[model samples]
Target: MYARDVRERVDAGRWPDVAAVPEASTARTAITRRVLRHALGRLPLLVRFPDGTRLGLGGPLVDVHDPVAFHRRIGRSGLIGFGESYLAGEWDAPDLVAALTVLASRAAELVPAPLQRLRGLWAPRHPEAQRGTPDGARENIGAHYDLSNELFALFLDETLTYSSAVFRSLPASWERMAPAQRHKIDRLLDLARVGAGTRVLEIGTGWGELALRAAARGAHVTSLTLSAEQRTLALERVAEAGLADRVSVELCDYREATGTYDAVLSVEMIEAVGAEFWPAYFEAVDARLAPGGRAALQAITMPHDRLRASRDTFTWIQKYVFPGGLIPSTQAIESVTASRTSLRLTRRDGYGAHYAETLRLWRERFTDRAAHVGALGFDATFRRLWTFYLAYSEAGFRSGYLDVQQYLFTKDAARTDGAPRETATSTTARDTTTAAAEGETAP
Candidate 1:
């Protein structure tokens, strides 16, 4: 019966159970159960079994329906197995974000020190095919961003912004999301000194929102993205706003991007660049910057120690959500810039709490529209996968395990061309001045 169900799911374009869960307990499974039992008992979380047994001291609740299967999965694959067990309905959480937050908060102490020293022996390494080479990058980008434009649209705001938004206040409402996203973009533009007649090069054009906003500032923009789906929609958006002449959206890789620009902008895209290519990525940015040009980047970051510990390990996020992605620590960013590029990190703003709120909004919206998502050809298992991904990310930020930052980099010296420094007032004025020209309201 279970095999028949799995076959049915596969035929319906759903997540298939490719690997069989161990049905019998082995010595390895027994050790896994004991280790997990000991670990959960120390955490301030409640792990309940169907037989009325429980673990942990009691906090957020995680109900294990098929405890044997859950233990077997974890015994086989560790964290990846934990996520797969969720997909396979072996366990569930009433408040997934809260449950995950509890775990994320104690991530560093989850395992014993002796076993921690042997992470390389137990953890999976990144696959060679998932490397961030030119061809690999295109394939990786397509795997996520090119999944379905409509699928993303269902969760993202009207602006179609995928990166974290800088909110003015906490407990951000849905109506404030789009404006907050625009504010985030304007802040980056202001940092990069974007204004009239500036030549802008944007990496990772996410549906052209940043490009449109830049072009609205009277800057000529060239935006590059590896996702062909993104390029198609971004070009349509550019044309729709009557800014086609000012904004050029190209389906190209960042390494292949040509020409130098006055300002360069990238948002939350560095995570996709593998650790091995960090130096090359920074070098590419350096090579494309004209003298005195500025570059602004919004990046999701983790602690330097955590990055070092997990940089080589393949986790659930790498396997199921974003293949070839690794969040860099701010220290890594600084070190790369110092060693590989002339660009200096001049200013940075951290808003990890805002990212927590942003993910909350997205998760709620995605949950509220689950039926619509299913109607769009996604099955229950796929929905569960994304739910886990979103909540897991929210928990990371909520627990302060992850953070997002906007960084400004200046080449050797400040602008020598006497371009007026951009201020909030100038940014708002530019928006107002160009709104009528573009036949649209200022973003």
Candidate 2:
């Protein structure tokens, strides 16, 4: 009989007594008894085993009730269980990530939630923020990127780029690929053409890696960021790199940044501006660039009307993680930049796989450093929430639900009709090259 049926019978006190056959081994009987005990605890909840065993939580199962709803909520053993259960609030584990890690690395299993079946037909849609003011931008950027710098540092590469990494190959090497990220960033810098003595401007400078790299290339760089922590950390990085004279990090919103630059680059930042404000973002970039300057941007893109039918992960992210953030499609970015000051899409690359790898690395780092993370003032629940964020994102990328892109933008003037630089290198050239070759989608 199905577990659900057994559960119902057990609930009505009609459960059968333990079989006492002489042929049954004592160990086997004991194992069955123990499983039944656990199942009894999940009485009302249906626990699904990967082997098609439906265990009822009534009767003997009640003796082994899940104190934390671990079995009742997440029947499957892995990241999905922890993430799905936490999102549904079925279980209350102090560290969501930790709880998930245990299940993720365990034996094969899947536990389905009863509520998902009940609410399968319901879906609520929200209006997209077509337009947003500077205030809105500040709120969105701060909400997601402003999470603890220490947490970010623990997992990110030396550059600390929060966006997708460019991998050199499929299933990129973790042991031999430490230098892949450096090459990818260098390629982006070359695309911008910010060379020695070039006056460069960077918008949404999260963690200041790009700004520091530009300065290291001998460029006079001005960087803008909305997060106070980011600005502080960036300034510290600049000072340590002895680029204080050439690099200036400002705690200002992008809308307020004004100046002419030999080149401009904004990595994974424009998506937060919303579609309505995209024109302003392009204009801001145009205004800051010199007559022949180039601009490069990296962002995540989705299809038109994407996420309409799928679960609204955005709803959860908006409410709990990224308050006002939004992701736009490539069409949106193209439309916004088409009209103003003749822009050309010089090169394009997709680093979705790189991002997946990055997330995996983050998951490992976070799992390994759980103790330190707990010590950093984040409670167990917060840890689980953070883990869910990374794991689901990793799964999303692996499953092709998310993408990352790098675009090279050049002014009509910079197009001098001359061929652009094909490749570039940095002190961390090997790392960047490995990443670019593995994950980078060549244009």
Candidate 3:
């Protein structure tokens, strides 16, 4: 009989939900249980069961309440099912980020070597509907960014800067986040040589922060975004700042954008550009970049090997958090620029640890404002999903498996005379040293 039939029978009092009762079993479930047991035993984590049994060498603790359901879910959908199991209350972790950090650190070695090699045969691929075509890009971007700006404001700092911040120091305080965000924007502007009367093009107008800053610097800024929600709120914010005359926020895709500018700035938008369109995205940037102009991009990146291995495999992040997102590697960026455009990678600064801290602050704020989130009409499942997403991302940065970088690129014939030189060399050196110590590198 089907599992659902048995479940209905039990619920109707015809049968009891007990270990003594016969239950349907599948080959997939049996294999998943065995593989999971083997894998969990090797990791540096503590997996506790209701029966007082424990697995792994013990680091962060994972408490499993329904082993059968957990195994079944994983069997059916792999990592995606793992996330769903959490949403279903089959598992709990006292310290979610710590537990996930352990998993992320050992992610490459989770499955057996043979299975890892054969992943393409069994792993789920990204849905074609989520591909980043012009239309698909709008749909994909709207899926996340259109989720009310008020919801984001509950957690994000006042600046509404959704990307990573460059903190002045470690143990960042809540008071420092907004200033750090501005610091990061100013650095990108400096790298792009933005100045008075300069014409600037912002590829992704994230609530118009960069555009507002560029306008404040006396530059005429034209910013593009695909999200209708962002465009609406960004326009409001621009008007509030009284910079509407200098800045124009358009609900336009980079591919559809017209006109050349002295500087092109896209912060943390490259991840949303699918790998298939990376060349197109860069070509668009190159096409609009004025001669002797520079471009600055802030991107979240992964190791090249990891990027290649996971690019095609569907994950929980792709399914729920970011529909069409794919983190590129420094190698991928360098290769794409060299092969596709005249843009050359001039400088890169990695600050993954800062991103981890930023996420920590955001998660804490989210938790503290859970009631407000519920009041806004988001259900429990959504809250759990967002919690998992934020912690999962934070763990990735903590484990050195992911990094956020600000990259500076200049065209082949770019003139150097007007470009701004570093005024905070000491600070840059310190940040670079920390990044290097964390195993981050520039291409």
Candidate 4:
């Protein structure tokens, strides 16, 4: 705790110093220019600065509103400071997602290879205080999810599903997002084989959509969540859906959950498990799973090398977005399960492009409902931060730097399969899904 306090104090003092500085040092500009040239040269991106200066060969434009601050921040903090620039509104792009996609495509090479391993020397460590302890988890989860249901409502579809939505195919626009979201959940429910007489356990119930769906299928569900705001509304939604008798919503930690379930599922919740407690999280799932039971998880994953290199390093996403979150690679998940538990990775369906489209639709919806979001008491800065977050995520997928996947994990893989799936697999969505699948996909 003392160490965390000291680090927080240092960061508090440092960001102000950076923000107050009027100009970058001559040496800093030289470094920034060199990095930009190598980093942006291969990409078709145009970077416009305050002084009418520009960089990049030219695709979409990155308008650097405060070049000096940006340069200084980059010189000091590297990629994280670039995100801070976005939060500070120091830079923008004509098409934010497109411009970010250009950068995300080169994220691996942005700082040069030799320096990548050196990130530990300066990269922020995930704070000790933010570990997923019972109390810490609630505080961190509430920082984003419990802010306001109305705030999320401004942007999300009627379903209120916050994670990546899988689509049959990438839609051209936002009009089809609602149905696509249902389809996404449908696939997970299918993977878990939720049906009549099934005793299902769902972790991280986001507004009761999954629970409602499970109940609709005549399955009895016990759903867990940390957000009080979400729990209230989720229960209300369950009652409204007239499935209250079949579904139970509890305000509890995953570690606190008891009783066995015939099937277990969590949607995009493992990211918040923190690497330290991943084993415990899986253990909780294992303990709750009945013999021959199945588990399906939707995850967001990064490439293995990137996940390994950056898993312990904190970033803008951890700072201003989802605190205590980490995108686990397939290797990390497989290794954790193999070493720590009996569950085996049986099948995976990945659709990174689908996530890009899902994010695009959410960003558009968020922007289109800006006034409503503002009226919900979120300030302009909040809007900017969230906009950047959504766009940044969209870019990650667009560049194939990130992927969303559904995985079927079972205790007995040989005994589990041959049941009919609700949907066919796709290279993008489900067609490519297979029981023999071996690569990583995310929840």
Candidate 5:
């Protein structure tokens, strides 16, 4: 990851407005310096340069290989350029996770207020090609999930679950985390009450893990995914497990899916569905759900204001990882369902710390399997990019800047007495769910 050595190969390509600005360089650098100084003053991050000069409050130290390059990039492109600087190897931290955690802690206030307001000049718009139309869904999903089955198998557990795993304990070793994945699927099945005679519709089936688990409970499952790679492998996995008779894997979009199901479940797929299409996504689920049916989903959520502020901004994760992705705030979900759909959120269990540990295990596995990953055709720069992505995500959850929740929703049918199924003003007398010292499995 030498400075600018792999610029062409690593950069996804610059946005149209991201160009050289030699005339404004000094003014831009001044603004960058001021904002960086203000943000660092709130965190213990010491940024050191080649001249033996260092700045910022002292804690985890960051070594800037080229201060001019680093500052120039951020000055030109704001936060997206900040991530690009990492790929360009302009700076590195002794403890990347700790350093990033500090930054994420002050994420909302990082840029100076004046410049933050002018973000549209720098922030890239979400690409139209990555929008969530049926056709775009297939293309966008394939962009990341279809990287290669062999590639994913290199690091993912045998379960091949791409979503966050609900762990039985924190600090779980890389080799011992499969049970947690299984436990996660089992709990989701329980939440949706998949039974012997139930028909289940699974949206975003990742290698058929959840569908298989549901079939084991004797439910008939129809699983849909837009990725051709996932469907091919998932269909094979279902057969390999001798449950092909019970599970149907289709390379189909959720919007076009028909037939009512007794239960509907989606795990962390909402993030990939662009926020603008959220109402339609939920409506599709509602449409395919039978009368008195239950639906459960696992979603990653951010704070409401942050979601609102950053919803339209192009992000590094959206560009290099999950294209067109956006994490919704819990309030946003609640509001969408309350106003646009007949569904009511009845139960929620948040286990975000489990996701941090899950990412740790994955990062360790991915790094340990670097040789295998290289054989799968990913370059060193690609490896660095993914490593940073996973670590950056872990730090968000570890710092409580992110959360994952399993929600149970039901059709809001009126009772025989003509009252709503559940009142908004209901008493808060229900038992609270708690995580173990290590995040616990939901029961």
Candidate 6:
């Protein structure tokens, strides 16, 4: 519809202000066409209109006015650039996700993007994850996760788990899922079966929520993370809670972790490890758990209908937020884990509502601390990046393209046969039910 309107206006000799011939100098015209073609030329995709006319322009050239910057974004960040550019007002799209969906499905056939990507292969990989050289694990973790602990705390429930919460019990605020988050922590602890004097291992222990909570319940906890900032804050948190003696935060890669534990739990961290490393991730978990130990793995899962993404969405996330992050379908995770471990998927729980609630809370928290965010030295453009990250994430959960899943895997539990226990209070949680259940089930 937008493209058709633009075309009709152009044909009537009433082009947009930016489209005027004088408005575009020789340099600008050459730059605009070159950058637009370069981004769009790679993908051979189309959008069909109601009248049966087709309108497609490869990659989007919506609000991007600076040709030089346009080239840099696609050439440097690929898909991430496209999104960041939009947030920075480099371009505009009427329906961001829809445009992205089209491009992502056709990304493999795109040639120019690969050629552009090759141009930077010789340049030292920017310390980004996914494509770049290892700047140590902490670099990217800090780049994204450690942006503002206070901001996270403001929105996240008291537990500060930062992953999807199991709303075994839904809360009235369905918007924030605060009550459900508390239930989620309880569920995770229950699955772990940590008792007084029990030893536990927590992988991707963001902010040390589970570790501290377990320690509070009298279990000895060892938490591992790649982020130095997280460690510093986590150590402080443990000390503040007087759990420093029982809860230890260490900086080590999950693959290199050692020591046996009675229980192992990982929350929302597997996606960052890349699909190639999942086998190793599970192997390390299995090796660290003692006989009869169990593990609870929580993560974001893609719906079955979301077969693919547009080039824009794919490149955006890969390049900017989580480099190397892959939200594989449920089958992918099940297949990978089942291939190696004797571990059985004792319980599989997905709550799209909880995630929508989580994102809503995060966005609100981030907005509340917008001034502090600005104080972090990020200019307006950078602020836009963060804003878009939060907004799009919420949109994703709301659209049902994403999900939050908790998969309980047991090593040698005697009671590995039982189903998830239901709670009377679970039915009260309703926020995520409407949005998540509706959006998540859709393509």
Q: Candidate 5 regions off by >4 Å?
A: 1-24, 415-443
Q: Is candidate 1 or candidate 2 better by TM-score?
A: 1
TM-score against truth, every candidate: 0.90, 0.67, 0.89, 0.87, 0.91, 0.67
Instruction: Identify the superior model by lDDT, candidate 3 or candidate 5.
Output: 3
lDDT (10s digit) by residue, model 2, range 184-227: 66777877877799998988878888888888899998999889
What residue runs in model 6 are displaced by over 4 Å at the alpha carbon?
1-78, 91-136, 148-158, 167-178, 303-314, 412-443
Per-residue alpha-carbon lDDT of candidate 1 for residues 157-230, written as tens digits (9 for 90 to 100): 99999989877777788999999898888888988889999999999998989999999999999999999999
lDDT of 4 at 85: 68
The lDDT for every candidate, in the order shown, is 0.84, 0.60, 0.83, 0.78, 0.79, 0.60
Model 2's alpha-carbon lDDT is: 0.60
| Candidate 2 Cα errors over 4 Å, as ranges | 1-84, 87-132, 173-178, 307-314, 414-443
Model 4 Cα lDDT, one tens digit per residue, 210-277: 99998999999999999999999999999998998999999999999999898999999999988888
Stretches > 4 Å off in candidate 3: 1-25, 414-443
Q: Tens digits of per-residue lDDT for model 5 on 1-443?
A: 34545454453444222222123468879877777766766677888778887777788888888677778777766667777678767778868888888888788888767766877776778888889888888888999999999988888898998878776666677666778888888887877888897999999988889999999889999999988899999999899889988999988889889998999999999999999999888888878887678898989999998888788888888887898889998788877776667776767778888888888888878989988998888876778778889889998998888988887777655521222233332221121224422333333
Candidate 3, residue 121: lDDT: 88
On lDDT, the stronger of 2 and 3 is: 3
lDDT value, residue 61 of candidate 1: 92
For lDDT, candidate 1 versus 4, the one ahead is 1
lDDT of 1: 0.84
Over all chains combined, what TM-score does candidate 5 have?
0.91
Clashes of 3: 0
Query: Which structure among the candidates has the greatest lDDT?
Result: 1
Off by over 4 Å in 4: 1-30, 413-443
Q: Candidate 5 at 132: error in angstroms? A: 1.0
